[model samples]
Target chain A: MFLLTPVLVALVSILMVWIFKNSDGGTERRKGEARAQAEACPWVDEDLKDCTDVHQVEEDANGWQESEEDVEHIPFSHTRYPEREMVRRSQEYYELLSKRRSVRFISNEQVPMEVIDNVIKAAGTAPSGAHTEPWTFVVVKDPDTKHQIREIIEEEEEINYLKRMGPRWVTDLRKFRTNWIKEYLDTAPVLILVFKQVHGFAANGKKKIHYYNEISVSIACGILLAALQNAGLVTVTTTPLNCGSRLRVLLGRPANEKLLMLLPVGYPSEDATVPDLTRKPLDQIMLFYFLKTS
Target chain B: MFLLTPVLVALVSILMVWIFKNSDGGTERRKGEARAQAEACPWVDEDLKDCTDVHQVEEDANGWQESEEDVEHIPFSHTRYPEREMVRRSQEYYELLSKRRSVRFISNEQVPMEVIDNVIKAAGTAPSGAHTEPWTFVVVKDPDTKHQIREIIEEEEEINYLKRMGPRWVTDLRKFRTNWIKEYLDTAPVLILVFKQVHGFAANGKKKIHYYNEISVSIACGILLAALQNAGLVTVTTTPLNCGSRLRVLLGRPANEKLLMLLPVGYPSEDATVPDLTRKPLDQIMLFYFLKTS
Candidate 1:
């Protein structure tokens, strides 16, 4: 009976250890399941998951930059307009931009490459975080490559619409008339794929952090849109859901680059239509703080 | 001593449970410590921590949107430019924008409020994800309020530079000649504080998810910058670290609105200077995919 007691104790210890290990294993298994679900779902928010955060954690002691060399400061020239000219100029610019719309129905007519180059140059003039300029513009004109991109995006979007997205999202989007099918991918004469460099290498080959890279890149995109409008081109801004990795690999972008936006640039087709939408007025969007009653 | 065996068995079981509970508690304690450290650090990356993420997780079953009514589609009328005109317009636009520099030294000369209204109106034309237009432009003209903003920003920035940031970040910013002291915030005639609406209230008072709200607001800021430049104004884009919540509260912005970027808008001082920086060339930043030999 004494021997039996010892054996019982041993068995109980083994059972307790097994239960604890199994419970822990179950938690890990559920995490894996959730990740799998996230991957398959449509709204995969991989927009700003830059490698800088990982490197920052791993190399926390190294700080963010390696360059200690300072640049010289030069006097900034000014172009001050008369108050009346400023008002007139600002008003004219607003009228020009207000006419801009996101046109999805694009004609397959070829556009001047020089115009594209100039607009991109204007976009490059955007102010970046720490002046990193962590952006890449890939202009794809090959018909076959564009077709392949369309296929990949459409396939992923189909899964998103049919299997992942709930009825509410789908219903909300019915107004804009967007769906899994992307005819613009195949129809637009040119596709500008915008990639944000999550991190850049310093001259010494150490990682340089691109601070606020996503916001900087999007700002550049805003300028690109304005330039395109100025040049009389039409495009629809798109952030293809769950297609960044595949498109990155397809475009042969480096590991440091991730897709931020895709603009299919061309002229609008004859039958092109847009949802009749109106923007918030000046009072609704702009707040003048503590104004004097002068 | 007759019940000694049973007592010992019970003691062993109790000890095992205690060990398990203690180990789990250790993990939680470690996590809490890491979070506390993150809160104290200057590079607190609260840029895109929107409430939509939380709502999406909690209300995963309901989907993202609640509106089902559709808007009418209208024919898109576009102005097609001649190839020569397109090239000329694109080139002129690029040249005008390329002259823009992030000028920090601002004169206290008051800008026309009418121009400010026009610039903000132009920014409102930016394309947003799902057409949410989730942005608010707060123009602070009151000198006292601007001074208050300067105080809040400098207080946080002083902490960022002196206590939290490593020497590396300070070194990186040395070339730009930027420090915690922001005289421009008070000197500039206008302070435009850009805020991103993380979420909006639905017509039914339910939470409405503003998809890609950060990117949308950044894009709008981009257009705002361009409009300012077109109006011959000088401003610098500043994303003051760890000062968002305080500035938001100071501006009386709602909880749903998070500060994205702050631009102090006015004419550059006569002796205002800029760092001698150069942007990447077009060939370096742009890629032409598989050009045809025709």
Candidate 2:
């Protein structure tokens, strides 16, 4: 009986430990499930995942100071126009940009490469965080390569539609009449793939962090869109779901670069149609705090 | 002695449980420390923190489809230019944009509010993900409010430089000659604070997830920058570190909105100087994959 009592004490201790460990394990299991859920959603691309916190402080802290430490400051020349001309220019620019639409049906006719180059140059002028300018513009004009890209994007997008994306997302896109089949990918004469360099190498080959890289790249994209519109070309902005890695590998971009956006640039097809969409009026989108002029 | 054996066994068992719990507690403590470290860094603003994974699928999943379901499709009209005009326009646009610099020195002269209105309107035309158009432009023209903003930003920035930002980051920004004192915030005629709507309410008051809201808003800011340059105004793009929530509250913006970028808009001061930074050449930034015509 005495021996059994000792055995009972030992067993009870083991039971207590198991109970505590099991509770902790439950929390760990829940975290694992959450991560799994995130991975299952293909629209939540790995590329979109924010790793800035991980390397923000560790890598080359500031590219602007590091790169331009030796460069001299120059007087910024002014380009001030008369108030009348300023108003006229701003009004005309607004009118021009307001006419831009995300045209999907791009004609197969070849566009001037010089125009494309100029538009990209305009995009490069966007101000980046710490002036990193962490972007790569890959222009693909090969029909075979374009077809391959389309195939990869379509395959992943099909999975995104059929399984990965929930019913809600599918329902949300119903108005656009968009599907996994991307006809413009095959028909558009040029595909400009924009990549954001997550990090660049310093002169010593150490990693240099690109701060706010995704935002910077997207800003450049906005300028690109405006330039295209100004030149009377048309394109659609697309971030192909779960296709960044595949496209990156296919295009032979370095590990530091991740696909941010894809633009199929060309002229609009004759039968192209757009959903009659109107933007919110200025009052709705803007708020002003002006000193009460007595 | 017989009674003592059972007590001894019980004590030993308790010791085992304590050891196991202590090891688990160590891991939990480490995690807490890591989180605390992240909080200590002021530049790692909560506003810049990515929360898309949390509500991405939960809120209005497909805003494009939901909002535009009833809207009718219309034939798209496009303005096409001849090849020569397209090239000329693209080249001129590039030259105009390339001249744009992040001008920090601003004159106290008031800019025409109408031009500001037109530029914001042009920014509103940028494309958004799922047609969410999730952005708000807060134009602060009241001098008192602008001074208040400068005070808040300077206070936070002082903390960022002295305490939160490590020596490495301070060194990184040394070349820019930027400090906590922001005279432009008070001197510039307009302080355009761009905010991103993380989530919006649908017509039914249900939460609508703004997919890619940050990127969308940044794109708008890019177009806004272009418009400012086209109108011959100069401004510097500033994302005040750790100043989002306070500035948002100061501007009386809603909880759903978070400040993304702040621009001090007006004419450049006479002595305005810029860091003579050159962008990456076109060939360096771009790669082409062209099919060989047999």
TM-score of 1: 0.90
Residue B146, model 2: Cα distance from true site in angstroms: 0.4
Q: Residue A226: error of model 1 in Å? A: 0.6
List the DockQ of the predictions in order.
0.58, 0.56
| lDDT (C-alpha, whole model) for all candidates | 0.84, 0.83
Which candidate has the highest lDDT of all? 1
Return the TM-scores of chain A for each candidate in numbered order: 0.87, 0.87
- Candidate 2 lDDT, A123-166, residue by residue in tens: 99999877889899999998999999999999999998897766
Judged by DockQ cut-offs, the docking class of candidate 1 is medium
Q: For residue B196, what is the lDDT in candidate 2?
A: 89
Candidate 1 lDDT, B1-294, residue by residue in tens: 133466567766786786677557646755765565453333544554533555354546444446677799999999999999999999999999999999999999888999999999999999987787899999999998999999999998998889666676677788898999999999999999998898777766666667678888889988999999999998999988879999888878898888888999999998999999999999988998883456
Across A112-176, the per-residue lDDT of candidate 1 in tens digits comes to 99999999999999999888899999999999999989999999889777866666567767889
The window of 10 residues in a row where model 2 chain A has the poorest summed lDDT is: A59-68
Segments of candidate 2 deviating more than 4 angstroms: A1-33, A36-43, A52-68, A290-294, B1-44, B50-68, B290-294
Candidate 2 per-residue C-alpha lDDT over B29-95 given as tens digits, one digit per residue, 9 for 90 to 100: 6576556546434345656643444544434344322443656789999999999999999999999
TM-score of model 2 (CA atoms): 0.90
